[model samples]
Structure formats: structure tokens, C-alpha cells
Target chain A: MRLIITTMAIIVAIWLIPFVLSDESGLKFGWPYSVFFTLATLFGGFLFYLLRMPPMGPFTSSRRAIGSVVLVFLVSIGIITLLANVSPQFAFEGAATAGATAEERGKAVFNDPKVGCFLCHTVQGAGGTRGPDLTHIATVAANRKPGMSAQDYLKESLENPGAYVVPSFDNIMPPVAKALSPEAFSDLMTYLKALK
Target chain B: MPPDVPLINDRLVLWVVSELHLLFAAFVLGSPIFIVISEILGVRTRDARFERLARETMRIVAISYSLTALFGAAMTFVLVARYQTLSNFIFQRFYPIFGLYATFIVVETILMYAYLYSWDALERRKSLHISIGVALNVVGTLVMFLMNGVGSFMLTPPSSPDRARLWELVNNATWTGLNLHRFIANIAFGGFMVALFAAFMYLTSRKEEDSAFYDWMGYIGNFIGVAALIALPVAGYIYTKEIFAYNATISTLLMADKLAWFFVIQGTMVGLLFLGAGYYMWLSIQRIKGGPRFRTYFRGVFWVALIGLIIWLVPQNFLPSLTTKPAGPIGEVAIPEKAIFLGLMPAKGLAVSAIILVTAFLYLLYRQAIATGTMTWGRIDTKAQLTLTFLPAMAVYTMTFMGAVRESARGEWHIFQFMADKSAESYLTPLGYAATVSGLITVIFFLLVSGIFWLGFKVGH
Candidate 1:
């Protein structure tokens, strides 16, 4: 009983630190994050206590063995719950609230989490290196395929990605058309055309 | 273009069948290596128990070999029918080598059956019988090595595929590392399966002698499993380093961008394996007369493993996937700068190395206990047997999880940079979805393996 009280006291004390600091310093460490850290610290304390126990024998009864498994299972579920709760939720506010202009909205669409364009393609200095950098894509798009205009090429690349494989790149571009609203698709095309 | 199969998730079907194939394949290929060793020991020690163990395990290999072939044939059909375009490309590139692969498989099957059927006939000529066992291992390993060439070629194909010779294509950048990793893993996996079999038999045996023999067998099986497991980290490190050397972009995609969450789960499962192995060792030690004397050493080892596990579970980002933002107000706040260092490679690498070291140390302690004290077989607590059972499940889950991570690391490509998966199923599935599929595969495999164990017992009776 005393050990339980002491553990609770320590957890409460640790949890208060983040809460108080965030309130005073204008930081945004939310309640869920604080709860996660507190639980993690509590788990650490539990491990420390377990380590300090006297040398033990093998579990002599089926009940004891099952109880141990139950304890481990509960702890595992707790960890999974905490992780899931702390994970970021998906949102499209970034694209939805951007300026109404085609290029501006297109840029927003490109960076939107729902669209996930930046996960593979780089523009300027940001995004991933898996696909080609689109920093100068506007200039190169026109010359990529003869008799095809820059807008036409970019449109084809988005709709039918396997139509023309780039010389040095794999044909890995997904059909972004499926992921976009028609308006968002138009905006994304304008954004790509204006990359120069 | 890849052909589409109606009314089914083609990739998921292929994933399940291929994973099942690999599981059975690992057992067949891995068990023979140790079976030969057991046979040799039986001859040298003049111990009939060793001889019985060798024969019993050979029976299991015989049963599992057919499952391996069945799954292999199913996977082949799926590849030919659903993935015709990619299949054609590979077939055209390595037509002659596929013939060699087929020939080796046929030869391996013939040799395996002969070794099993000739156990008694060559009992008088123990040397010749042992020779056949060794010959069987050689052919099984060659079969795996040749297939490794084709698998690794997909990940790290030659730079100039149009002009590269056949040998160069086979000996790609990641081929040797993968071969070494899989070789060690096969031994470890085989050992766990053996332990699982022993645990089941021990639990169900009505006679004291059977229980005692199974108890000893479980120890040996777990010993082999943990021994190989201790060496796996180094092999895995070499494989990862080779991948980085082959392509930095692909490495980034795995470690940082898309597949990082999958790796985090893998680390957790691996930590469970070490914990399970350590706990079983601790329990086994208690059954020895003088084992309690080593309690101090066990405590220290336990602390090392616990700390290592905590460090390994830390993720670089709190986000579950790349595209999402942190929920609620936390979304506006970045992960604190100070906490970032703990999640990175330097700390994680140190933690993994420490975990491996502690496991090895625990095994050494178990060995010392056995050397100094008398082992009371069939006298271990039920919990120890349960732990023995748990190790195999963890091992299977780890295998399936890691396999998923490796295949998913290819992302939208059918063959890395060489060929694209332009099928309807080209995109990367979410980590949660892939994990669910992997879990399903693990459960199905356990059920089938249990059936195989039952059949082997019936046949022996």
C-alpha cells in the first residue's frame, strides 16, 4: 500500500512539471503528451522496482504463470493505447484554408497531407529524394517529349504515370489524379507549371 | 502491364502464399544443417538418445518438405498468372539460371528422401549415412543461395542491366549480405521450431521418460536458437549497411521516410524475443541444483536487457505515419529538441549491441550452471515450458514482420529501379494494414505447423 502511494505521488509530481511549464512558458505540450511521458516514467519506475526484488524461483503454479502473462498483456495494451492516442491525426486544413488563386491553391495541394506529393517529389529544397526534383520541372516539361506541351506532359504524368518512364528514374509515380478533387487537380497542375 | 485477378487483392494473396512458403522453406533448409550435426554427435557420443532425436527430426523434415513445395508451387502460379509482365522480364533475363535452380531443387528433394529412408540401412555404415546427411545440407544450401541471387537482384540490380553479364547480375551488390543473414537466420528459425515441437510433446506426454527426453530436447533447441539469435544483429547490420551503400535514396526511404514505422514495430518484436530467451534461461537455471548462486549475475543481465529494450522502443517521430500531423494542440508543437537524440541511430545502435551482448552473457551463465550442477530434466516449472512455447511464436512473428518490411521497402517498384509495378496495386500499403496481413500469416503458419507436428507423431507411432 505504501509503495503504491509513493509511486502515485511520484507520477503526479512528474506529470505536473510539464503541465506547469507549458502554462507558464507559452509552449504547447498538450495534456496527452504529458500523460504519455508520465506513463512512460511510471513504467520505468516499475522496472526499477522489479529489478530490486530478491532472487525469485520459477513460477510454481499455473495461476502465478497466468497472472504474470496477464500483467505483461495489460502493460502491452497500455503502451499501444498511449502510442495511438499520441499519434497525429490526419487533416486537410492546410490545403483548404490556402489562398483561392490557382497557383497558390495548387502549392497548398502539393504540400497537403492528403495529397502526399511532397513525400516523394522535391521542389526547391524541400520534400523527398525518391522521385525527381521538380525545381526546374517547368522548363524541362516542355522538352520531355516532342510534340507534347508542358501542361500536357504534366497532365499525362499525373493521370497515366506509366505512359512515359523517365530515362534515369523508375516508373514509380502513382496516379495522383485518384487522390485529388477535380479543382485540386487543376490547381496542382498550375502549381507544377509555375515551378520555374 | 501486370494482369489483374478478379475479386481478390492480388498483392495480399501473393504476400500470404510467399510468406508461408518462406516459413516452410526456412524449416526444411535450416533443420537439415543441425540434423546432420545431431547425427554426427550420435555417432561420436554413442548415445542412442542422440540417434533417436536425429531420426525423429528427420521425420518432421520429411513432412514439412512437402508443404514447402506446395507453397512454392502456389507462389509460382501466382507470379506467372497475376504478374505476367514482371515475370516475363525476370524469366528473359535469367532463363538459364532458373533451369539451374530447378535442377538443384530436384536434386535436393531426391537427396533428402534418400537420407531419410536410408537411416537404418546405413546404420552399420554410420560414416556413409553421415556423409549423405552432409551431402543433403550442401544441396539444400545451394538451392537457397541460387534463389537468393534472384531475390537480391530485385533489390540491387546491376548498374548496366542491358550489357551486364549473367554472373554480374547474379552477384549483385546486396547478394552476399542477404545470403549471410538468411543463412544464420535459417539456423535460428529451425532451432525455434524444434523447441516448439519439444514443448508440445513435453506438455502432452503421459510417461516420465518421454517428458524427460523432451525437456532435454527443448533445452538443446532453445540453445541453438538463442546462439544464432545472438549473432543476428551483426549480420543484420551488414545487410543494412550494404543497402545504404547500394542506394542512399532507398536507405532514406526505409530508415526515415516511409517504412520507419514498420522498423519501429520490428524493434519491439525483437526486444520481446531477447526478453523471452532471457526469461527462459533464468527459469532453466532454477532447475539446476546450484543455479541460485548465479542470481546476482542474472539480475545485472536483466537490467541490461531492460534498458536496451526501452531505448529500442523510442521512435524518431511520434507520428504514426509520414503524412499526418500530431493530434490536437500537440500538432502545433514540435517534438522537443532534447528528446530527439535518444530516438536516432547512435543510441539505437548502442542499445541493440548491448541487448545482443547481454543475451550472449545470459547464455554463458546458463552454460556455467549446467557445467557445475546436475540438471533435473522434466522438473522445470510450467512457466518455463510456457516460455519455451512463447519463443517460437515471437520468432515466427519477427520473421513475418521483417519480411514485410523488406518487400515493402521497394515501394512503388516491382524491381527497385529496374522495373515498376504498374499494376493496380502499385502504391505502398499503410503500415497497420501490412502488419495485420503479417499477423494473419503468422497465425495460419502456426496452425499448419501444429498439424505437421501431429502427423509426424502419428507416422512415428
Candidate 2:
């Protein structure tokens, strides 16, 4: 009973001290202090828990050691879970609010799941890398075939991705002509043109 | 790339959790192979010690098998929650295989339980028990091969008009090499764990007879480990060669980009592994009475490993723009230009092969010394005994480091040519930071493994 109370008190104290210390005018406060405090508390709790547990030597420190390990393990994993749960919002906001210009709308469309452009294509090196990087796709399209303009090349690619498979790449691209509206497709071309 | 969701550092989570999963999985897969071998040895030779050893080993295997399942479940959850992009891609294409993988897991668990529990019950029916062990190993190996197929397909995916084709996805260029490499590595890992168990028993045993038995057991376990260790690098070479053939650009980034230094660190760790194993073998020579007579040959073995260490660690080249300077005629000279050639793949490959061969040969000598009755048993130095314990730790460390290298090779892509890693955490960590993180994870792994061994011991008691 004493151990549980003491551990809880220590954990509560650990949680409170950082906020209290940061409130003081004299000290420069940042996330580092909280991170440090959290880590120290975890370790302090782990050590105390292990110290209090019955000994199982050669093996030593009993099952509590595994508890400590799991505590650390879960905390690291929890942080990842938190981050993964949060990031998609930022990515969505950044894309959705890209603006009303042709190039901006094209980017929004490119990133849009409905259009599914970024599912296989890379744009300015930020999207899926399954398809060819479109960082300079505009230039490549111009000289890709004799007598073909860049606009026509881009049009062909959007409608028929299998027409020309890049060397070392599999022709796994599904045709996306029906997935995008004609205006969105034109905007996507503008975005590709500005990529260079 | 983003939905209206909170962000997480998926890469770190995946790396750490996947490594934990791999460690347990390796032990689970590796343990069965040797358990079957030990069972056969016992049945054939009618030795009680081997039978007890085999039974005791199964205890560890059973516990590890449970942990592997637990971690596998956790890893699946992590994939679903955190690595949705890659997870979705895999599941979308290989849904049937995922079902098959789960089925294998269930069947494997049943077989493993039966194998573990039936040892004493079917003692008189030795062949029947042995067959159960073989069935268990087959299921376990199938699990490993199936999992490796998924991982390797990501590294060298096959392109097709139909993206969801099971056969094409699973049979990618790198799959064969990965299966072979992982198969050998699993044996090496299992051997080390058995040796570790024996070492612990040797150290803790009160009776001289028990100690002697464990000492011999440790020797046999370590010998199996080293033999499999010898084949591991060759299998690794095949895997890397396939990756290079799949795409030169991806290969260049893995070998020479920001990740290059991690390979250097991997080489250093491998050198330490060779040296540690060789040194342990050299020390084990003390158990043999006229083991001293082979002292000259032991020294040769030591020198071969030391030289191999030096050659393997030589950097292939300086940073791209940094010019190499000629050595001075006097003191404090730079490493000669000619010396850098030794660091290249072919040269380092030869050096490592020579080291393994020499160490293996020295093992033969140790066996020969024991056979002629020139070697005394149960006479290892305390420190030398500690090195035997250290051998397994080194093996685990080498596996973790090399595993890190293999994943880092994927570099900014979840599936090399098929999918991109566009998560916020897709950036590659610097080599030093990554190595430190890996080292920390290795320590955690050792602690966890030690805990498992302890639990196994307690259960047996």
C-alpha cells in the first residue's frame, strides 16, 4: 500500500514540478524540460520498483524488470501512435488550402485520393515513388517521343500510363482518365509544367 | 498525403517494434531446428543428457514462441494504426497470403505445444515424438519463408499490369536470396541462444558433473553457431547482389549515399563478432590437457581474425569530394592509397572468408584435442567462461546492426519501386544517431532475452 502511494505521489510530483518550474520567471522554459522530467520520472520509478521487488538472481530483479522494460517500450510506441494519429490532418490542411490558382488546384487534385495521382507518382519528390518522379516530368515529356508536345505527352500519360513504361519500372499504372474531371486534368498539367 | 488526423513518427515505431518482433521470431524459428536435431541425437545415441538438454531447450522454445506471437500481434496492430500506407498496400495485394500467414501461426502454435508437451508422454514412442518436432519445424520455417517473401518483395517488387497478383508480388527478384539468407541466419541465432542457455547452466551448476555436462553442451551449441555464422555472409552477399541487379540507383543509395557509414559500422561489429567467437574458441582450448600444444595454431587463428578485422574496416573511399593524399616517407603518414583497395567489396569479402575458414579450422583442432584425451574437461578460466556468455550477446548485436542496415537500404521508400515513404518521419537519421539507437535497442533485447531465459529456468525448476 505504501509503495503504491509513494509511486503515485512521485509520479504526480514529477508531472507537476515541470509546470511549476516553467512558471518561474527566472528560468528559460521549453519542451526539453518536460521531456527531461518525464524521462527522469520514468527511470526513477523503474529503479524504485525494481529495488523494492523480490530478488531473482543470476536473473535478478524479478518480473519488475520486465515491467520497467515494457513501460519504456509502451511509451515509445505510444508516442509513435500519437504522431501517426495526428499528422494526416496537417497534410490534409496543407493540401486542401493550397489555393485557387491553376497550379495550386492541380496540386490539390494530384494529392486528392479520388484522382489517385500521388498513389503512384512523385511530385517535387514528395509523393509516392512507385511511378516516375514528376519533378521534371514536363521536360522529359517534351523530348520523350519525336513530334509529341509536352501537353500531348502529359495527356497520354494520364489516360494511358501503360503506353511507355520507364526502364526498370513495371507497367503497373492504372489508367486515371475517368477518375479526374477535364478541368482538374488541365490544372494537373499546369502543376506539372511548373514543376521544372 | 495527410488526412485530418494526428501525426506520429511511424518510422521509429516501426523500426523499434519490428526489431523486437524479429528478435523473438528469429529465436522461435531457430529453436525448433536444433530442438529436432537434439531430439534425434538423443533417440539415436540413447543418451539421457542429450534428451534432457533437448527437453530443456523446448521449454525456452515454447516461451519464445509465445512471445513471438505476442509481438507479431503487436506488430500487426502497429502496422494497422501507424503504418497504414505500407500496410494497406501489402494487404490490398496480398490479402490471401496474410490469411495464410495467420493460419500458419495458428497451426504452428498447435504443433509447437504438442511437440513440447509430448516429449515425456511419447518417450517410448520416440519416432512419433521426433515426427511431431519435424512437423513443428516445417511450419515454423514456412512462417519465416512466407514473412521474408513479403519483406523482400518490398525491396525488389515485380512490376505488372495487375498489381494484385499474388504469385508475382511474392516471387520478386529478392525473395529467393532473402529466404536463403534468413534461413541460415535463423540457425545461427538459434545456436547462439542454445549456447547462451548452456553457458548460464554451466556457470550456475553446483555439481561438477552438471557443470561438465553443460560445458560440453555449450561447446556443441557454439560450434553449430559458428558453422552457420560462416554461411550467413555468403547468403547476405547473394541478397545484396540481387538488390543491386534490381536497380542501380537504389543500390547506389544503399551502398554510397547517407547510409554508407552504417555499413562501415556493420563491418566493425562483424569483425568484433569474429574476434569474440575466435577468442572464445581459443580460451575453450584450456579444457584440453595438451591444448597448449596447439598454442601455435591458435595464435595463427587469432592473427587471421585480427587481420580480417583490419581489412574489413577499411573504408571503400573517402567522402566524394575529399581527395586522398600520398603517405609521407616519415612518420604520421596517411593510410596508403593501396590500402583503401583492401576496403573494397572483393577484398573485404576475401578477408572475411579467410577469417571464418581459419576460425572453423581452429574449432576442428579443438575437437581433435578433445578426442585424443589430451584435453581436460571442466577446466575453463572464469574470464574465458564469461567470453562464452559474451558470444551470444555479440551474435544478437550483429543481427540487430545488420538488420538496421538492411532496412536503411530501403531509403525513403516503403517499397523500393512500388511505394513511397511520404510520412513526416521518412528522413534518414545520421549514422551515429542510428547506431546509438540500435545499440540501446540491443541492450533492451538482451534484457528481454535474459528475462525469457530466467522464466524458462523457473518453469523447469
Candidate 3:
């Protein structure tokens, strides 16, 4: 019962302090309200628990400890979820808005959840480490294997990732030849080519 | 296209959560390295002390593993929910790798439990148990290396075309160097934490035998920490060189520009670490039945360390940047030309190296002093135990500040040159704010870690 009350008090303080004490007030008072309120709520809870509970403390009861754990976890998750969902400005939809040119469209495909190119390959240096970095794929694709041209190497590798595993990398990439249509594949290739 | 959400600084949110996650991750990754070492030492020497210590260490590791998972899951949620586009890009690129990483986690979890629970049942099959220890270490090290590769890619990404090849990105310019640095650092951190636990046990232990046992454990823990500490600077140097090679601008930003003060702060903490270790070792020499013959030798070491620290902490720049207005009067002092070398890279690097070498030499002397049988085990006093506590605290603080420096070095970009952090909430956080947040997070991290350690004490007892 005390744990529930203490947690509620802290939560209320978190919300109330921010609403009541504006930024100007915080600056004028020469105190960080967030830090002060947080510390106060914590100290208050500690004092409440110590004065009300027995000498040994609340944690002596396994039930109380477990309750506090569950309460804290739920409260933390609740706040984090609220913050994330409520604040859309924190999210980026740049790629979604910028897919126009062939290269840009290819980037979209590379970043697309459906195409899953990024699942194995990095475009322009920021992707998966499971496969090799393809930042300079256009430069090295032709020379990676003998008797294989750049296009041939890319095609063969996409169709059969295990055929020519890079020396240091594990051959864990599943064949994606069936996954990408020729047009989408071409678009990805365009993105890859523009990477240089 | 920023999402139409209301105000709340997501960058600050990410920074705090990620820092917390990293602290736990360090302990989780670091503890196993020493656990395996302690186990192997026991098996070879047939020393029951080593075996007991290893078991105790495993208990703590088991408790911390859950916290690590909890924080890791939280960090992932922040990435996916708060920065959806950025998370989507990374996830799309490495979903399969993520799958593999998850599989490793499951295997690692089972191995960790088996290693902890089957201690007595598999007592007779010692070889099999040892093999499990080795497997646990292997998987743990592999996980660190894999993550290091990903982290290195963010700082020094491959050029566009090379980024196409997943293997190339996996083996990015900074990957090997970072792996090596982190590997050494993990061992050192693990050893420090073990020493901290042993010190705590020694302080609270009522029985003479228990105190003696923990005193010995604390000594060995510090020993491993010093051993790893000796190699840390060299690995760090190599990592920095690789960063320089990959991108001069980013390296410059870290070492000489806006982030330079963080390095100075890191150097001060590192200098304190050396001094703390030296003081602890000097105090520990009292355990010798005969008086410490190396008192004069360690005095000289203290001098070297102090001098090195003074040189290392010398501010590289006293003035604010040309673009920014000075914060205070001290920021108006123009740096003298000839005295600039004192704050330069070579001077700072050499000073740090000297400090490390001096610390290492003191440790070697301690080992020799102990080997002569003149030193009896377990006479470490409360003061020495207090020093052990300070060492890990300083290390945690240093790591948090350095983490800030590293993340902030990229300026406004999330992926260095490749992608910009274009969200409405994205901005380069001022150093004052960053440092304040980092300090707060460090305190919270240490408190939580201490809580975990205390909880483990309840379980172990």
C-alpha cells in the first residue's frame, strides 16, 4: 500500500512540478526544477517508507520488493511509451519524403522493410555487418572473383550468397534473387552505383 | 519529414537511456572475461580459492545479465519508437544479423545458467565444466566484437560503393582497432568490478577466514585489472590512429576541437585511476611480514604518476571557439605559442603512457614482493578497501564522459558523413548539458550497479 502511494506521489510530482514550475520560473529561481523535484520526490518517498514501515525496511518483505519492482517497471514503460507516441517530431520521415530520383528511389528500396536489401547489405556505409560493406561495391564488384564481371558478380552473389563468401565474413545471407523483382533490383543497383 | 509530435528533447532521452544501457553492457560483457580466466586458473593450480572466487563472480554475473537485457531492450525500444526512420534503416540493413545476435543471446543465457547452476553436479566432470566456461567466453567475446563492428561503422562509415558490401562494412576501418580496445578494456573493467566486490565482502565479512579469503580475492582482482590496464593505452592509441586514418575531421573534432575538453577530463580521471591503483598497491605491501622494502621505489612511482597527471590534464585550449562567444573571462586568455606543446597530442599521449608504465611497474613490484613469501595474505585495512571502491567509481565516471565525447564528435549527424540527423528534435547538445546529463547518468548507473551487487550478496549468502 505504501509502495503504491509513494509511486503515485512521485509520478504526480513529475507531472505537477513541470506544469507548475515554468522554465522562466526555474531560471529566475536559479534552480533546475527537474532535478530538484526528482530528488525531493525520491527523498520524500524514502522518508515516508522509513517512518511508516518497520526498522529493517520495506525490502525485507519479498512481496513488497516484488510489488515495487512491478510498479517501477510499469511506470517507466508507461512514461517511455507516452513520450515516444506523443512526440512525433522526434521521428524522421526524411527518406519517405525524399524518394524522387532513381538513386533516391533505390535508397528507398534499400531502406524499405519489404525489399529487405538492408537486411544484409549496407547502402553508403550504414547498414548490416552480416554481409560486406557495399559503400564501394561498384569499384570492387568486378574484381572480387575471377572471370566474373561486376554485374555478373552482383547477380551471382544475390542469387547465391554462399557461392563466393568474403574471406572474413560468415556466409549467412540467404539468396534474395527471388525476393527482388528485376525492376526493384535494377533500382537497388542504381542506388549502389550512385554510392560512388 | 518530421512527425507532427509535441515537444520533448528525444536526443537527451536517447543519450541518457543509451548511456545507462552501455554501463550495464560493459559489466555484462566484461565480467565473463575474468570469470573464465579465474576458472582456468583454478583448474590449472587446483587452488580452491580461485574456484570459490570464480563461483562468486558467476553469481554476480548471473544477476547482472538480467539487468543488461532489460536495459538493452529499453535502448532498442528508444531507437525503434523514438527515432523510427533511423532505426528502420539500421534494422533493415542488419535484421538477419539481429536475428543471429538474438540467437547468440539465447545460447549465451543458457550457457550462463548452466555454468552457474551445474557447478557441483559437474564437479567431477571438471573438463566439461571448463569447456562450458570457455564456450561462454567465446560467445561473449564474439558478441562484443560484432557490436564493435557495428559501432565503428557509425563513426567511420565506408564510402558509398563499399557500403554496398555488407562484409566490407562489417570490417570497417575502425572495426578491428575498436574490437581490440574494447576487448582489453572489458577485461580490465571486469577485474575492477571483481576487486570492488571482493573489497566489499572483506569490509563486511565477520569471520577471519572469510576476510582473509576476500582480501586475497581483492588482490587477484586488482592484479588482473592492472595486467589489462597495461595494454589498454596501446590499444586506445591504435584505435585513435585508425579513426584518424578513416576521417581526419572527426578525429580532429575529438582530439583538438569542441570535444577536446572531454579528453582532458578523461585524462584526469585516468590519472586518478593510476594514482588510486598505486595507492592501493602501496597500502597492500603492508601485508608483507617484513616491512615494505619497495616503499622508496613506490614513492618515486607516485612522483612520476603525479607529474604525468599534471601534464595530461593541462588544458589544450583555454579560449572558446572563434564562432562562439566566450563563456567567461578565463576563456579570453590567448594561448602562448611555445607553451602550446604542453597541451598538444604528443605531450598528452606521452604523459599518459608514462603514467601507465609507472603504474604497471608498481604492480610488477607488488607481484614480486608477494612472490618472495615475505608477504602474508589478507591484512588489507579499511583505507585500502576504500581505495578499491574509488577506483571503480572513477572508471565509471571516465567511461560516461568519454562516451559523451564519442557520440558528440559526430556533431549533428547520426551516421557521420552518410546520413544527417534531420529530425526537428535533433541538435548538437552543448557540452555543459551533455556533461551534466552524463554525470547524473553515471551516478544513477553506479547506484543501480551497486544495488545489483548487494542483491547478489543476498542470493550468494
Off by over 4 Å in 1: A1-14, A20-196, B1-7, B321-335, B458-461
lDDT (C-alpha, whole model) for all candidates: 0.77, 0.68, 0.68
In the range B221-249, model 2's lDDT, one tens digit per residue, is 78778888888889988988898888754
Q: Which candidate leads in TM-score?
A: 1
Writing each residue's lDDT as its tens digit, candidate 1 over B1-461 gives: 12433435788789999999999999999999998998899889997777877788889989999999999999999999999988898888888889998998999898999999999899799888888889999989988988888888888889876578999888999999999999999999999888888877776666788878888888888988998999888899999999899876577757776667677667766786787788788878887999989978987887788778777766655554454444454333334555656668999989998999988888899999999999998877655666667777767877987898788667656787668677766656556556656766876887788788777684366
Complex DockQ per candidate: 0.10, 0.03, 0.02
Tens digits of per-residue lDDT for model 1, A43-153 = 656655643444444454534644554344334433433343334322212112334789888887786544568878878655666788898899999999999999999
TM-scores for the candidates: 0.79, 0.69, 0.68
Candidate 3 CAPRI grade: incorrect
Task: Return the lDDT, model 2, position B292.
Answer: 67
lDDT order, best first, reads 1, 3, 2
Q: Which of the numbered candidates is closest to the native, going by highest DockQ?
A: 1
The CA lDDT at A4 in model 2 is 62
Question: After superposition on all CA atoms, how large is the RMSD of candidate 1?
Answer: 8.2
Q: State which candidate, 2 or 3, has the greater TM-score.
A: 2
Report model 3's TM-score to 2 decimal places.
0.68
Chain A TM-score per model, please list them. 0.52, 0.55, 0.52
Q: lDDT per residue, candidate 3, B1-461, as tens digits?
A: 23443434677677777878777777878887777778878989998898999999888888888888887888888888888877887777666667778888888888889988999999899889888988988888787777776777777778872246777667888899989988888788888888878876776666778878988888888887778878988998999899888876577556654455566556656776777788778778865855377778887887677767767765544432212223443222323344467767788879888988888888888878877747555566555666677677666666777787777666556777667788765544444545556666766776676687667775467
Candidate with top lDDT is 1
